[model samples]
Target chain A: MEIRIGHLYPDLLNLYGDRGNIQCMVKRCQWRGIEASVTEYQLEDPIDFSGLDIILLGGGSDREQAIVCEKLKTIREDFKAYVEDMGVVLAVCGGYQLLGHYYDTDQGRIEGLSLADLYTEQGSPRLISNIIIENEDFEMPFVGFENHGGRTYTGDLKPLGKVLFGCGNNGKDKKEGILYRNIVGTYLHGPLLPKNPHLCDYLLKNALMRKYGQAELSPLEDREEKEANLYIRKRFLERQ
Target chain B: MKVRRLMAVWTAKIISAACRLSGRQGVTLAGKIALKIDPGILRDLSSQVREKIFVVCGTNGKTTTNNLLCSAVESEGKKVICNHTGSNMLSGVAAAFVLSAGISGRLDADYACIEIDEASTLRIFPHFKPDYMILTNLFRDQLDRYGEIDLTMKILSQAMAMAPEMKLILNGDDALSAYLAMESKNDFVTYGITEQVFHDQDSREIREGRFCKKCGAKLEYEFYHYSQLGRYRCPSCGFERPPIEYDAKNISMEHGLSFEVEGRSFHADYRGFYNIYNILAAYAGAREAGFALSRFSQVLESFNPQNGRMEQFSIDGTKIILNLAKNPAGFNQNISAVMEDPSEKDLIIVINDNAQDGTDISWLWDVDFERFLDPSVKSVTVSGIRCQDMRLRMKYVDIPSTLVEDVEKAIKDRIQHGCGNLYVLVNYTALYSTRNILAGMQER
Candidate 1:
């Protein structure tokens, strides 16, 4: 079976190499013998979340974000359905800001899917920086950059990872990423997957297992990926 | 070095304060401040920048192109860093990256894309060691600061020297951008308009940049797209818009001109044929950045240029199209777009005599305000601090101007009863204040 990915607002919510996250995912999944297809949804278009295994969102300025915010209003109900049903979703920086309950600024307020246990206040003084994230349960690295004035105050939710490098998800706060069942959220940026290839393999495996029902999917450890995991894990350990 | 830098800081402060009193746009002030604080401050900040750097530079479409490239990368699910604020310089860039780095000084991401100004490019490139440089477009802007085309070209040459390894993503129509293709070591890519917008003519209105550098010969253009950008080849030097890596095909300049790249057409919600090329450059630059066309196309199709650029706002039954026009080339293109609306819109052209607007206001003479004589344009209202200068320039074009004063009043009087759309053209210094005036008018 093939893993289908939904790229939400590819046109409106993209400002950086946000799509690189998808490419990294597609390559990792395909290398592990999983088929993946990404469907992009634009403004005012129908939100068909059918057969979707993953979704990706990215960052932009307040003005750019505002445009997408207008479009997102109409689809809040659709996004809420995905979150409640335990759909696998990934959002970074502005995308992460957008997925939360609210993204507020001086002008007005823009609402998100209210999926994860996160809330953001735009124009706040809690500007976050580059992060090195890890969770105690999973001895792996979660890397990405954060440059936002929006302060994210996490509520009761499972932490995605702890800080291994520069800053954790948010500054001083041990909260970096949010991991809930099949949903993962963080401010980690481009090249995040490249630095954390182990996460890529694991996410791909998760998608593949659901697609093939654990019957036809390849084994978790290939010679190449096993070497890569070892190397990446050592790099994370060195950071510690 | 520190002592001299301290003195330069003082000099920059004095110069900045003097400029503010004189009502100058703060480009020169901030640039001077940067120059004073550290002669090589840009170099210092740039050294700290982790490689895999990307620099977006152009005249009309730099901001849009930079934003588009950033959008494509972000869609790839990467943490991408760029100047969210319009402060696109050494200091602004410093403020952005410094805030993103760790105490150990490691950047958060594997990539950094920056939009650099034309004038500051030379001093700043040594700092931004770009893996890829998207040279978006080159048009005549702030002739006073840039002097003439040749001076700007010289500065670009100096900037290019620092990043010899940078793959140049160029505008094929632009003489300045295409010139960098001569460096064989640097992998260069070009994007330009393929669809014909205007009838090709040798009219005096065409300010082509086709002067032969070899023998002072008036270079012949196969056509003219806006200024001197067209299919040009110096007969002496054999300089031409190279075979494009990603050429825009079937370009149409109607209703926010859209174009196709590599057989895929993308629509931008804004007008002007120039923007099509901007999107094209973004696509080429992003693709070279290892992003799939599918991902890049997805981001650009829904993108819009903000910051009072081709942005529309309504206040009490008046449709106002606010666009930023700083130099002669930009002002001229904006005029052409506004004139094409066919709805007989009211016109308000704001001019600034500020330093950021360029000390040499003489570039006004270069603008083809003669286009204003068309029937679609009902009335011309001139404002900004340099209103009289624009009035003088309009008089040369025989433009009758009974109403000329503050920007708000001009818009209010012209756009009062049954006016469809009021197009406001403000220079750099006047744009922010003009926008503020519009916001204030809405309050009333």
Candidate 2:
């Protein structure tokens, strides 16, 4: 089954070469005989997200992110109905913040759709570092670099992850991402699936399951077991 | 909180030490973290060491100016401290300050000459307060990080506001630099070019910041030396490039190029007429730092891009030259430099879709590749992740391209065939990878 991924703001939210993340995702999927194509959307460009299977967003500067947030603000209703209802979203760094409730930047434009329970305020300080997030529910370590000013505190919803190594963010609270249903939004950067093979498999399985049901996933029985063992070992060691 | 800050500092030190010990990047990693801990930490740390600081800042010419200023200042045989690793961030400066500054907060060098990053300059300037700040031309660069021209100008304007007493060595050709020096209350120096090259005289490519910031009038450019720069005049307000203290006149691409400044003619040992703005700024900044004019002139004329800026190499009858062109102005300068050579030359340009290189490939549209329509260029090769983008650009351009493919094969194919004088333009991300790939091909 073909899994379509939308690389939102391929131009704007591409600071620190975040395109490599999308390339790696497509490359890995192609290697696994999975048909995955990244649909890039730019400024003022019309993109219908109704048929899309997955969405990916990257990090950029405060200003560029603000422009994208403003641009995305117009299509917030489309996002709520389609993105929140069905499709999966893998947001990294600035991308994750944007997919959630309001990003009030002190310098420029701010505000985003309240899809997730995360509030961000800019002005205080930027958290720039490589981090390891531990997800208790999920058996893997999520790794990514986050360069953002503002602390995020979840009001009601469960966090996507817990801090494993390094600073997960503003406080030792160990919250990293917000995962609900098929939608997975986090501070984990692209090449996100490179470390957490389970999450990648989970995303692929659900994407395939959503499209072709359990019958299509039967071919991956033995392959999944072997890969899962190898993935667990590496994930465990990276956390250590 | 203090513990977290200390951990950040120690974490940076460990990363830097490990990197250096493993024979990789020396102090850049440590520097990156120091700034994260506190943007003002470097300046505060520097105060412990009693030494007058000198800063070199600009878009295209900071690296060149930094190198030039270093040479002239070192001529007096003073122990000059600097971040030569090209990490101009507060972290890098802080790391440099820590490594070079004594226990008493006194620096080993008589003077500190530093290369400063544009965005970080706003935050770092107030604290460091350099004795002399060499203001280089502000060009459109890393749009993902620095934003537009005017945004960068605001940050720089803020920096200028903080450091009033600091001597400014300004680039007169740059509208932004010229405007900054003109508006500054500090003692300032202006250095620029007279008339040279096919500067934005009669051209069509996006010139960022086409409108005047002061009067909100349509700013017109008589010539664009490099993006939004060059001879500009406000249509409404009569603000122009203030009279330069030193200027380079006779600007030409022909053999034996020289520019006259302050009733004196300056010559370059290298083909540096196009970047005379960088040269003159370096000259003035170095002179302001107490280097003699004779010493400044002598050092600048001899010093060329040693750190992979415009390095020349030869392999298998092919003269492979590499030049850094990360932005529009830089791209124009490097491409124009290739066209300046009368002899036919093979060309290769590698563009990456990496985070460091600015993933937005749209910057390629502004690069005046049409300037290379001259007869001197024979075959052109474009490569990297964004090779197709460059290929499409070349296809649109009037220039012809022989090969456009992935970097490894295109470069090797050209090198194997015995091409005469191949000039490769690589951005920051693709430079080392391309260099290593070429090195591997040569070994085989």
> Model 2: per-residue lDDT, tens digit, A1-240?
688888787656654335445544564466568788878786657878777777777766566666678788787888777655656777776777786677776665478667666777664444545466777667655654455565666665667677765455455577777776677776654235544556766676676766666414323222322332343345445667
Expressed as tens digits, the lDDT of each residue in B193-253 for candidate 2 is 6565563364444455455656645577667765666777898898776776777776654
DockQ of each: 0.01, 0.03
Where in model 1 is the C-alpha error above 4 Å? A1-240, B1-51, B99-107, B183-185, B200-202, B415-418, B439-444
Per-residue CA lDDT of candidate 1, range B1-444, in tens? 655544544455555567657655444445546555666644544455543678887777777777777787778777777765455766666544544544433456656778888777765665557788888766666543553455566677677776788888888777657765564457777777755557856354435344554443445667778776777777776766677668777777666566677888777767776677677877888788777866665576566566677767788888888998876567777877787677877788888767677643545655678778987777788887656546645654657654456776777777675366788888887777777777667777
Local accuracy of candidate 1 as per-residue lDDT tens digits, A1-240 = 577888876654543445556655776567666677878775646877756777787765565566777778787787778766666777777788887788778768877667766787755444434455666666555654455667676777777777666554456677776777667777766334544556666666566555455634454443332333344345445766
Compute the lDDT of residue B106 as modeled in candidate 2.
Answer: 38
* Model 1 residue A112 lDDT score: 68
DockQ, 0 to 1 scale, candidate 1: 0.01
Assess the local accuracy of residue B160 in candidate 2 as a C-alpha lDDT between 0 and 100. 78
lDDT for A138 (candidate 1) = 62
Q: TM-score per candidate, in order?
A: 0.57, 0.61
